[model samples]
Target: MLPNKSDSRRRLNATGLSTGDYNKVNTDTTETDGFVNEQWVAPNVEEPIPWKTIAIILVLFVGGTICICCATLDWLADVNQDRSDRIGALTIIGALTIIPGGYYLYILLCILMHRTGYTMDDIRRLG
Candidate 1:
């Protein structure tokens, strides 16, 4: 047996929605429910300078400089295979550290100097 349309509508209305109500569009434009037509705006707060990152780069640059200098001095005085190998390894490590450290240090200096298009945010994004 088929259920009556009125009975079905009454059951749906009891659940707080009628069948035809789902198809109806809200035509009212004047109501503001606190969030209507809201646009997002970025906050105007300034980011703090990244002191830790700068410090780390400075450490790497200084450490790499020391490593390369010591390695060069050691190479000039050394004749043994073990010392030469150690000097070569130190030079490699120094180069690895100095390359990125120097690049980022240059970027940071540019940012500090307020060069156009240079930003600390770029360094932050690299990590």
Candidate 2:
């Protein structure tokens, strides 16, 4: 007489256990549980401000404004004194100051206006 399916399964299981003395332990079960509890994930961060660039811009702005003011003062002093040599010298100096100062001021304003909220895309677009 042939044994039933359950009887055959029992015989196979008994033989497998006897042949291999190693135990079947679920090691991954505890490791998976610990990983779920920890819940590790990366975070988002903001980009740093370009402070050195800003400092350089401020210096250029201040220096240009000072040059313009100095030239204006010299011209005014010459006009008061009523001397042709002094007037010619001061006029030339003032003209030189006005041109470069205006250009520098415009550049500084552009920089200030475009200061914040910049990315690689924005810089590419600026070109």
Candidate 3:
């Protein structure tokens, strides 16, 4: 036997939803109690320290600074016997070096913050 359409209309009226809106809302079978399930993408675990990468970066920064300084000294020692020209060139090199130096400082600061008990919750809040 078939159910009556009037009975369905009566039930929908009791819930205060029109038939068209009711059909639209009930089409998605996966959603439960009006809350849709979502996939969690971001990891909630503790961050691991990259010791080897950090060591390599620090070593590269120090070694490159020493080598560049020595090369600059040697290059200027051979040419431009004047003080003003060497000072100008040094200023340019110093400006260029600031970018990498700033990055190195940032990496060190991140490591220090982690050492000082910075957690993922704190990071999420700040971000």
Candidate 4:
């Protein structure tokens, strides 16, 4: 024969055991209070300017400019086939040097002018 549910519940209660519903709903609505012992703050650190990188970029820009100018002048002064080939080579080399140097120099200028989205970190080191 099966035992009655009430008899089992009474026995459990007598033994100090709770057989009540475990999934009770919480109806109380109250805001929780939280506190911090100490507030955290970030340290202030300044980044130094990279002068050597700037100098290298400046040199490349100037050297490339001179190379292109000299090549142009030499090409205009003479129509010799050999000189034309040399001038073309010089012009290509000058363009290659000027591209990166000019780009970084522009970035440096933008940083100096305090432009938004431009920073010292934008300039890469050659070393």
Clashes of each: 0, 0, 0, 0
Model 2 C-alpha lDDT versus the unseen true structure: 0.48
What TM-score does model 2 achieve against the real structure? 0.33
- For each candidate in turn, the TM-score is 0.63, 0.33, 0.38, 0.64
* Candidate that beats the other on TM-score, 2 or 4, i.e. the better one: 4
What is each predicted model's overall lDDT from 0 to 1? Answer: 0.71, 0.48, 0.50, 0.71
- Model 2: runs farther than 4 Å from truth? 1-45, 79-127
Model 3 lowest lDDT segment of ten: 3-12
lDDT comparison, 1 vs 3, better candidate: 1
Query: Candidate 2 residues 34-96, lDDT tens each?
Result: 223123434455655555544554554566556556656766676566565655665566565
- Answer with 1 or 4, whichever has the higher TM-score: 4
By lDDT: ranked, best first: 4, 1, 3, 2
| Clashes (candidate 3) | 0
The parts of candidate 1 lying over 4 Å away from their true place are: 1-42, 79-82, 125-127
lDDT of 4: 0.71
Where does the lowest 10-residue lDDT sum fall in candidate 1?
Answer: 3-12
Candidate number with greatest lDDT: 4
Q: Write the per-residue lDDT of candidate 4 for residues 2-59, one digit (tens) a residue.
A: 4222222112234355666333222252332232222233446687777889999998
